[model samples]
Target: MLKIKLSIFFCFLLSFCFAQRELALKYETRLHTYLTFKGSLSPFIKITETDARVYKSNQDKLNDNPEFIIAYDEIKTFEQLVKNAPNDSIEAILKRKGKTKWSKKTKSEIQILYENEDRDASENKPLSGKRILIDPGHIAGNFEMSVIEQKYLRFVKDSVPNLPVDSIHISEGILTFATAQILKKQLEEQGALVWLTRDDNKTSFGITYQKWLSTRKQIVLDSLLECGAMEKTKYNKLKKEDEKTFFWSFFRDHELANRVKVINKHKPDLTIIIHYNVDEKNTDWLRPTDKNFCMAFVPGGMNVDALKGINGKANVLRLLLTDDFPLSEKISDLTVKEFSKQLENQVAKKTDADYLKDNCISSSKQGVFCRNLALCRLVKSPLVYGECLYQDNKNEYLELSKADKTYYGINTNTRVKAVSDAYFNAIMQFYKK
Candidate 1:
């Protein structure tokens, strides 16, 4: 009976030993430590030909690991020493490299950490970091988004006397499209999440200006039904209302309304509205008082003016911009200086034929030169709207008619880089917190 009991006891001990595991660290270099797990860390693990022999002091250098050790660095197998410990637990207490040491909870902490990338993409949102959104003002063409000079313009045979060949005046749609092209490429190069509301800047989007305006008008009607519809009380909670973007007509209110669409869409750090201003012969009645370049915009901060006089304002990000009277004044001041500097450089330094491709403006015999850089208003984010250049001014207008790098300030596709660089730097300063 006694002999049979001893056999059974011995078999049970063997089973427990089989379940044990061992963990070992092999140091091939000061920077490299190889970690391997045996079935269990049962104690002093054996060294094999695959393992190198090292000094006893080296064991001390290894922090006197409580789970497994070389014992004498000559043995082979943990059976030599009687120790039981969880390999994972000891891992929590190991040293990382020469200068760094693992924390007591390293195993738990490491397991808790995960590098996931799908988070933002699944929501169609950008990861939290630097993001830029650009709106190039125009597109290609003669009334088509890519083809300008068609939609907003009508050419009649010289009904008057002798007016040489038929000539074309400026097209708002074309100017918008062109600006968007320049704006898109420039900001993208600087790594921004630039997007355009329309595929191309102009052309009534394949419809007539009247049709386009009609659609835009409808957008305004839709906005009134949205949360921005005028309210007597403070903004109602968004969950209780359907917040939406509005429209911009030739009306200042409408123009500002367009900016709101992009703001809510991009949630960008800054917003810049690109445009070329018309001296509008009405300058007599509507001249901006400022000569710097007819630019206007709002500064950035908590409340969003894009929401306007609505009880429920659109959700403005931490930083918001607007064309309120104050913001318009401040941005106008800075824009004039910035645009003037760029125009002076474009006209004088990069005015060669090829350089003037995107910028076709030139001086006239009348001294009425077309100076580039008109009115642009950045919106939603630290906004600035720059005219970029005057289309009516002979010299400035001529420069803009070319694809020349100098005329566009960079390239035909996206020349707003100079401006983007300035804006980017400003944003970094603005949102440091």
Candidate 2:
């Protein structure tokens, strides 16, 4: 009897060890396949059976030393560490582990439990108590602002044969904001709490570009320089650059960071980033193009150069350890499917755009690609960065220019409304699953 009991105990231990090894293999496979853009093993990250180590560079790995070490079971604690010490180096955060407010709770802690409970209780309201965040890409409010941001579709009268409009001067930002507003309303009507990152004609900073320049520009530049995100030479050049250069450079990335900050703080169950696509080959967007395609981006696609910073490395680890990657893929897949079906646009193939081949990792899903976009990497929630219909496409431009509808006092076209409906349907399907 004693021998039999000992045999059972040893077998249990062995099986547990096997399970752990299998899980580690699974994670490593995911890391290489989905996260690494080049489909090669990253030099900065080393994974073992029990823990993953983040190295500052290949030299650190050669020394067999890591900057930060996170055990498999301590993923939740590591998450808290990063949040509490967003500016601190990963090594510093790990060193002061016990000093920080660490929690042993799982990733899907109180908030998710409450969301599930609310979801269970509200059968009639499919999205009841769910939180959704809508990020309208870009800060341009009008044609002039759009021109400054270089995100507008422009064409003179008769630029394209049989063009419906006398001229086309549509701002991508305006379209995104309109689409986000419509989607927010639709989600809210379905009993979800929705938040937009910015107001109409405004930026994620809660102000217009002009206002930000007048009030916060110097302060932001100083902070960027101090943080080493901007070099001193670049900071000096920015002071002399025109407003357009400023918007294109520092303001752009900082605003995106602001969006990420707010979205992470909101802790939304899902995030939707809205943008109108344009033909990458359409230089200057001076005229319409025959190309129209739909695509969606999720996290991953991190190259070697992308892992230069502590924050970027931390985010990569977060994505690898958490369910964000798979969930993002699912929702993005659904979104692209709906966009193709509703808009009568084809899902973009890897061959459709050069960037799609060179800069992204194509997913198994038809139109979903894993691109290392700013919001894609930093936003903590499962998100879909949607590039709907191409704004520079000939027919799409005419259709999107029609001011046939208005929602909440915002003027938008039927095409934009259709895009909103596509997103709404996708969200509904996501929740149904």
Candidate 3:
């Protein structure tokens, strides 16, 4: 009885001390402490190495600053950071300049932001003043320009079995960019501020495939040497190694990192990733089969590689601090609904787990699911990654392949317009309430 009382007292003391030092605590220590609550940690607070961050998820309410980020140089192991923090209590910390502004707001207003339940949908110009970022998946271009979304292109052959692989026809990069362009124009027309991650079919990384391979070798060597990891004399030997290492490790990975940086910089209220799905049954994209589907992704599918480096740690922190997942899921549900409605009951049903490895998670809606896709997981905003329609469906293939018709500066089939319209309507419906 005495020991139980002592334990309870000790836990209370620890909690009090933590609350006092929370503001000044190191990122890792604070995250660890915050994650101690069993109920609070469920469905969130993941610590995976998906993008290379120390901590992976966050929980920020309206008017609440995300995490108190210490300078990189000041960041230390949990013990080291907490050891030297001043003995200011939580109340005292709130009194400090530029600190705990959340306390200044009305409790009711804060509650409103937290719940955000009674927020009304706008009738006209619903998206006005909203900042939106559009990321078109893949690095694609005209047939002669060389395709860079190698992952998706390869999947085309592997998705369908026993199909003779021929010349690449449909490119996810090109199609997505085209879709993004249309969406951007429509959103802007609705009074929303919009931006695209990439301007053209090539890449947002500032280099094409030809130039990336040719010039990246020396650049990688210079980076290694500049970071004091390589000696001048060893440049020749390391250059050969870096040639292969740079492409996958730095080049490909860094491209995604760069995109994340820009998206965070813009601080969009929402991020919409445009992608076209493919039928796993139809590998031969030249002749599309009847299989089709529509789905969208929110965050939460984190795996081992999520917390790999500094950006990965930052990504995890951003995800943890922001209260965006619920909203992301809501918008994705709306998008799936709007797309299904637009497709006239042609939406893909829940896929079979035996064939589709990424089976749909249980949700209020049919097609929408939380996936751990890179853009879906990394972007620090309400994100909806829409796999609008299946490009491998025979009807969709013909519709998508109708490139002779021109709309909004790119030659696209009427189907592309329909896809874009579905997205526009979904966004409008989501925001208009």
Candidate 4:
């Protein structure tokens, strides 16, 4: 009887060990972890000889639970991972290899998850050590400033031409800055380290429009030279080129490059870009339209064309080996939910218009989308580019024009406050304990 009992106990132990190993292998093979570059794994976690660096959320707690680290020669397509499977299942093969590599190219990837990822170390302040970056879209200034900066103020002149009724010179730079300022205050209140791409309406890149105006293009030209975008030998020749030629190729790219550099320098965990939407059908945007909607953009929708610049290959690798896209999408969904909820609750009136997409709406409930925009593609961190509401919508225009109108307990302009609240709520909810 004693001998029989010992045999049954050994069988149970073996079964439990196999089950734990299967679970570990499944966890390691997931695509989400592979996409995060330089991301940390648990201190004692091990990977198969075919693995690369593992990425962990900076917010995740240290956990060394995985039992079996599946190896692969190189992370290829899903089809490739399964193509060479023998009669024994892929999971079984991984178990049999026991960390041995069939090919010379296979090498184990290592990362150590530190203890600091847990932001909730303190009881009250959840986001104490977290860094958040906010970027307001576009740059606009007075007429001369606009000319100097080569970015015009987006104005919807009243159809009557002289009357400013239903007219708005919606300087996107101004609106976004206002939104960012509001968000910064809220985030700071919540114990977050907040940084804005630009402090005010002026562009963060190069000299201010006012300064440039006084210098008469010399300031900008000097900036281009200082930034290495222009060569000293070709200075005179390139400076004389037509506005369109110089502005599009060299000047625009130089400015964008500066913004990207600043963002990467900060190395913030998340980036939020704020903007107001305008109706595309109404080219003039002269009259208020009945249409209005909110949407959020994440990184994706890239082709080979998008991969042509110096950062192109790097960007491709980031998309493939980083969690930026998934993280962006997750934040975007939260943003959409919060913004839509706030709009519905705070708006004086409700409109029939809601979420709309250029292509087929993938799901009736999804409000976040992938757009291959320069900022979305280039920014290193997870980004949520938000277009809160239509500026040209009849009611929305009036709401945007209002000053100090209270809505949903907020004292700012209804539209601006609503948009700000949406973002605030989203962030709070996303980072809630």
Candidate 5:
């Protein structure tokens, strides 16, 4: 009796101690955190049940509290940013205009028709047929002595640069720039008028958000980061008025204002902004039994198909760009299906994969995905944000980087060609429809 009582007392003390700790972290309005897990740390929390998965598939018992935990090492928490940020990161990132604005000027350079490689003759080739708008994304810094004061005021005195720290690597500008280049080449070949959002060189990287919001700056400090991790110092350099710039900028620059300007100017029938993805639950791709770099996103809008308003944003307009090829590979139209199917054959000839198993197409790391977020939601036009792959994983990065493309890492021609082929086929289908 005495021994049993002492054992029970010991167990109670351990349970009491374990219950004292909880996953306490903060999330602001638009901020998020993703945790990576490999083992059964599931025994810890009851609320995190859905995110937990067991290995070997034969476990009679499940780990309620996972042995380990992971979360995003955010330099700037969204709430801190929202509270003190000068401009909204999202908005500033997708800004339509630059700090140094330009007058509307048209330069008549040698232009080629979609069908023929030859430059357009001095003869008037007024754009007939469908017009398309392609936004490449991002600009580089400038070195003009005249505008130095203006630029310095923004970076030095401005509240936030929207996406601070590493704009060169994971920013929207670089990825969009790549996708736009491939898209432009392909769309032009098919004879569509594609007006890109940015250019290849630094001359058109757009104005830094830092400059735009220099007039009003606010600072945000992260209490969680380690020593010499300048998150706190970087936070204080901004003024107050830049609060809503992030969200507003993305809408205005990427979706509404910038796109509207292009549409009003040229009246494109289609518009697309290519992008990649980041998913924390990426073990399948990261530690793969095979090499498969795959993911997809859907268009956002109301649906007669289902009546769920969980993530509905009215999708604003009937965006037809969502249904554009390279954006969607599900292939609804017969003509496009046939066209893309043939292209799959070409892809198989050059690439090594069991293409037939995936219905002659496979954008999955393993099998088919039911929710293709980048392709489905379109309030205005048929628009979908086609994601290349996850950037955070090493294997997927290696596979996705197999192209002749290189951001910070070198890739082979095959990988680059594969992504190019997918988008190209997607475009061909849109025109066919």
Candidate 6:
């Protein structure tokens, strides 16, 4: 009788263990199919019955060593642990295990999770007590800056027939900022606390491009070299190169990193990155095209190369364990729907853009894509990177250049206000869900 009971207990334990292993495998398969760009097993990531491991390279995997490991049971705790730790603390942990260096933090603060339950029930506002962050796309302050950044829409007189002006000069940065300003106001009226990543004409670093060159350029270059991101020869070449080269290669990414830092530090419930789209076929944006579409990006599409870095691996682990990815996709889907309806632009198909086909994973939602953009991957919150309308379309250029309205001294067209309303409606619908 004792032997029979012992055998039965052992059988039960075996079945439980097998069940856990099956669950882990199923989770990993889902991640590979939905999140990875190629939908294949990454050489840098390994999954066993009990845990997932992230390796620095194939050599590390072969050697049975990993830089980071999180047990299947402890993934939730690990996600919370990362949220509570400061960026520097997290970086220190990653640096000790591998060579991936994160961007320097401007300041360290313990992120406080704002619970919706804490809001007063008596509040009448639709988005009462919600925190939101808006990131306008680029740092082009004027036409000159936009030309330098290559985000300007330029066309000679009579490019499209009935012209509003002799020339069309539409800077994407200006349009995005204006839209954000209007959106911020709308959100504020609904009792949501909103923060913009930068003021008008400024980078995420809170300064103009010229100011960053004067102050922080050399220091950033030195840090990049120390971290092995810039080779010594390349570093030397960059020191002597013109400002345009620096802006293109170094300043742009650095500013984007700063934007991520700012958004994460704010610890918002939702983040919105606003940008006006352009025709990918419209090379140099010197003229215009008729192609117009609306789209939004959520985080995913990581390849093996992206998985090799410590930060990338950590972010992937977070996405796999947390609800951030799903929430982002849901919100983005709603926003894209609203954008198409309001702007009267078609949702982008997989074949609409080359980069979308090459670099992004199509989501189940029609206009929402999973792309590994820096802001999409690192913001640590549910986000929508929205591209509202094609600024380089001949009709769009004329409409966008109208300056029919001014919000907070930012001159924008009536179309921008409509875009803001689209975003506002999306947010309302998202919270209702």
Q: Best by TM-score, which number?
A: 2
- Return the candidate ranking by TM-score, descending: 2, 6, 3, 4, 1, 5
* Tens-digit lDDT string for candidate 5 (1-433): 9999999999998775454332222111001111101112222222221121111122322533222111222111211221122233323421321112212220011011111223333443332244666644334223231132111111121322332322112233444456566656666655556777555423222434444334222222233234454454444432222434442422123333444344334434555545544442433222312222343333322122321221111121112111232233343222223323432321111133332232123322222122223223321232334445444433433333324454223223343445455666765655554
Instruction: Give lDDT tens digits, candidate 3, residues 165-189.
Output: 4323666677787888888999988
- How many clashing residue pairs appear in each of the predictions shown? 70, 0, 28, 3, 72, 0
lDDT of 6: 0.80
lDDT of 4 at 418: 69
Query: Model 4 over residues 173-238: C-alpha lDDT tens digits?
Result: 556667787888888777888888775546666566344335646776777789998799777866
Q: List the residue pairs that clash in candidate 4.
A: 35-321, 35-322, 39-55
The full ranking of all candidates by lDDT, starting with the best, is 2, 6, 3, 4, 1, 5
- Model 2: per-residue Cα lDDT over 62-142, one tens digit each: 886786767877776565545434455444555544223335553334223323323333646889879899999897888
lDDT of 1 by residue, 43-158 (tens): 22233222322212335335543222222121211211101122233233222211233343642354344211122333322223334455544433443422222223322345
Model 2 TM-score, 2 decimals? 0.87
Best lDDT among the predictions, by candidate number: 2
- Please list the residue runs of candidate 6 whose C-alpha ends up more than 4 Å from where it truly belongs after superposition: 1-26, 39-41, 47-50, 59-66, 91-124, 158-164, 222-232, 406-410
The TM-score of predicted model 6 comes to: 0.84
- Clash pairs, candidate 2, are none
| Candidate 2 worst ten-residue window by lDDT | 110-119
Which residue window of length 10 is worst by lDDT in model 4? 107-116
Q: Which residues of candidate 2, in runs, are more than 4 Å off?
A: 2-7, 39-41, 80-93, 97-124, 222-233, 305-310
In terms of lDDT, the poorest run of 10 residues in model 6 is: 102-111
Which stretches in model 3 have alpha-carbon errors above 4 Å? 1-124, 144-148, 151-168, 214-217, 225-250, 284-286, 304-321, 345-350, 353-360
Q: 2 or 4, which is superior by lDDT?
A: 2
Q: Report how far residue 99 has shifted in candidate 6, in Å.
A: 20
lDDT of each: 0.35, 0.82, 0.59, 0.57, 0.33, 0.80
